[model samples]
Target: MVATVDVRHETLRRLKSGTGKLATAALRELDADYRWFGELPAQERSWVGTVAQAGITSFVSWYANPTGTYRGALEIFAAAPPELTRSVSLQHTLSIVRTVVKVVEDNADELAAVGGEAHLREAILRYSREVAFSAAEVYARAAETRGAWDARLEALVIDALVRGEVDDDLPSRAAALGWKPGPTLVVVGRTHGPLGETQSAELRRSMRRAATGAMVGIHGEDLIVIARSDQDLRELASSIMESFGPGPVVIGPPAVTLLEVARSARAAFAGVVAAPAWSLSPRPVLADDLLPERVLVGDTGARDRLISIAYDPIVRAGGSLQETVATFLDCGRSLELSARTMFVHANTVRYRLKKVSELTGWDVLSTRDAHVLETAFALGRLRDAGRASL
Candidate 1:
């Protein structure tokens, strides 16, 4: 065992003395793997050559004094320009290291005073371990840099959409990130949770698994998913509800295109902001479902929606349905009271309330729907009498 250790140490000593010879042979062997080397860009090919030389030189220095490492043994990778990593993948870089390590192992005995395969192979293994660790460090740093750059770009894209300030360059920038903006999309709820790397990635994975061609962007806690599929967005939101915090997930109205998502985003945001008004709302609630809540909170768009869908339909019908709704609701939803005031039987009042529900889809019997109807009725009357412009 002692002799084995001594011979291995002897091999390291010989290899360190033959650094010049080792570098020449390793470069020659690396060039012989010409197919992959030639395919690299000219600049990258030159980088590979420089790194190969540095690896041999570094190994000799490290073997001469194993504990005496310098700059974390990353000087070899750092010796090349930063663009070298951009041109050469970690896989390619590791391949170069393997080639150089193999050259040292195959030719170690030619430089040794006494040839022994086991001893030289041991020395090669020891040196190869350091090179492998250094290679990992380089790749890890590259990955971190790429991740930070991508995060910034992603934040920019999301901000533009959320702010509705998408520039002409947005399409190309999005394409660079493999984002294909779809026409059919919805800006669902955003920004009310602890967002970390793992959860963020899990959220994106869930979106991808939910449908093909889905793109996700986040700025701060605000996350927007552009789902291409025509499935019900509310249903989609429910499926992805785990991605959110302990608050309402307001789904914007489905948009026909990314460019049209501005309206959807506004609606979703308004719903999110107004969600506290409806304490019993579902976890993933539709933005339009909270129209009454939104309108009360000064959302002109929500008021406009209520006036258009509920009031206009009832007013346009003009079959006494509107008057009966106003009377029944004003009369505290008492059938008898409404009938007595209008000088009709209670059954006649019931028939009119049902008709109003059928026309506007807002059942006057339901307290929430009744409130929406009452607000719409007041707004509609004000508009018709020229007392209000809304």
Candidate 2:
């Protein structure tokens, strides 16, 4: 027993004296073996060197008392900045551990007592295994922290959009979250009740699978998703429609890039407000499709757009279309009555209606399009009358 104790003491003494050399040797191995090691920024590389030195020093202390607690493995990583966990991946860390162990093993015979090389090699293996596990814990904790921070940042960006308070920082903040210049759109809908972490993560994963990039935010009962994709925005919205709660899912118009995403988000938010007005609207409805409802709810932008789309074009066609449409709508949409009121052939009235649909893209024959056209024409006439009075 005394002989074994003396050998152990002798081995520990040598390991303590050579910790610096072992660390340097391990770093050399890293530089020689790993291409990524040299590519790390200078500060990060310095941090990695600190970590390697910490590991060797800790291992020597653990060797001094083999039966002591194994906290040294964890303390080794504490020597470096936390950001090192991100710069050096878990795989690269394990490689570092292996290289350090190999360095110690190569010198074991020289460092150990006359008969202690085998015991020194075993200690290296055991200590390396503990360090490997510690590295994993460090990386896992870093990932959790990073994920939490990203979630908060995403919520902030989404809130800014919902409130129409976007600034120049929005694009930069979004870029930090991996959003780039690309076709993007916003979707507003009800969330699936309340989401726990697991469900929220799954929903996010599902959305990402459907688009090139996706960010989600939950405000009260609302689920807002901003997605970028090479695919059509409408198709991307449809693919993720089932992820929302049982309510209308309104898709904003696509933005050319993240810098313009606020416009899309604002339109989507407006659509969500106006969607309830259209009770029979599709689950994934376009914000533009709700123009009439949006106009009814005091959206001046929608009112102007509706007039431009449905009324101005018919007047611009200049074939007596405005009078014919107003007369036909006033005559209960009856061709004969319209023709009689206008003193024209019924076919003439029919031909004018066709031209109205062709020019305005709103068919007077359909109930929905007819209401849109009627509302737009009335709004347009009201605006003109106000201007004339002015």
Candidate 3:
């Protein structure tokens, strides 16, 4: 037992004395074999060297007391800044560990006492396994921290857009979370329930797969997704509709860029508020399609959109379209009744109705389009009356 203790002491002294050489050899091997390490920035490369040295020193300490607690093994990674994990992936870190272990094993003859090389080699392998585990734990903790921060930052950006409280910092904050400048759309709907962390992660993964970039915000049961892409937002929204809870999923008009995102958010949320009124609407319906419903719920933006899209064009055409539509709708969309009331032939009423559809893009014969047209005309007349009073 005394001779075995002397052999361990001799091996420990040799390991302590050769740690600097082992670290340098490991770093030289990294620079030669790993192209990524060679391309690292000067400061980051220096940090890598520090980590290699810290790892060697920590291994020596662990070898000196093999039966002692392994609690202090994590300090090996503490030699570098937290941001190091961002650039160095877990695979890359494992490669580093492998290279360092190889260097130590190659020098076992020089670093161990007489007849102790085999034991030292085995010890090196065991210590390297622990180091690999330490590296994984460090990266896992870093990812958890980064993910929590990103979630909070994303929520702030989404809240600003929903409330129209946008500031200069919004774009910067979103950029920090990897949002790029591109077309933006807002989708709002209820969720199955408040999302737990695991479910939220899965939902975010699903959304990101559908868009160039996406950020999800959960407000109670309401789940809001801000997605950016060059593809048609309505089509994109349709693809992701299944992610939302069963109910109306309202998609806002696409904004040209992030700076204009609040406009889309406002309309989308208003559509959600008005969605229950139209139970037969598609699973994912456009906010613009809900304009009449939104106006009924007191959205000024929807009222203006209804007038512009359904009312102003007919008035601008200066034909009999405006008067003819009024008569047809007032007569319950009956061409014969409208013709008798307007003292014209039924064919003339039909021609004018066709012209109205051409001008306003809403077919007077369809129940839904006719409702939009009727609401637009009423709002237009009220607006004109208000103007005349002024």
Give RMSD to native, each candidate. Answer: 6.6, 2.7, 2.6
Kindly report which residue stretches of model 2 are placed more than 4 angstroms away from their true locations once superposed. Answer: 1-5, 66-73, 317-319
lDDT of 3 by residue, 1-390 (tens): 123778889999999999999999999999999999999999989888888898888888888887998754378777788888988888988888888889999998999998788888888888888888888888888999998988888888888888888787888898887677777768999888888878888988898899856888888789988887788777888888889998888888877667567888889889998988887787688899999899979999999989998999999988788999999999999989999999999999999888888777889999999999999999999999999999
Q: List model 2 lDDT by residue over 3-36, tens digit each.
A: 3988888888888888888899999999999999
Ranking by lDDT: 3, 2, 1
TM-score of each: 0.63, 0.89, 0.89
Where is model 1 poorest over a 10-residue stretch in terms of lDDT? 1-10
Better of 1 and 2 by TM-score: 2
Model 1 misses residue 282 by how many Å?
Answer: 3.1
> Where does candidate 2 have its weakest 10-residue lDDT segment?
256-265
Pairs clashing within candidate 2 = none
User: What clash count goes with each model?
Assistant: 3, 0, 0
The residue-by-residue lDDT of candidate 1 on 269-387, one tens digit each, is: 88988989988887777888889889878989888888999999887898788788889989998999999999999999999888988887889989888888888877777667885
Note the residue pairs that clash in candidate 1: 183-256, 183-257, 191-221
The model with the greater TM-score, 1 or 3, is: 3
lDDT of 3 at 2: 26
Where model 1 places Cα greater than 4 Å from the true spot, the runs are 1-96, 103-123, 150-160, 170-179, 182-249, 255-262, 314-360, 381-390
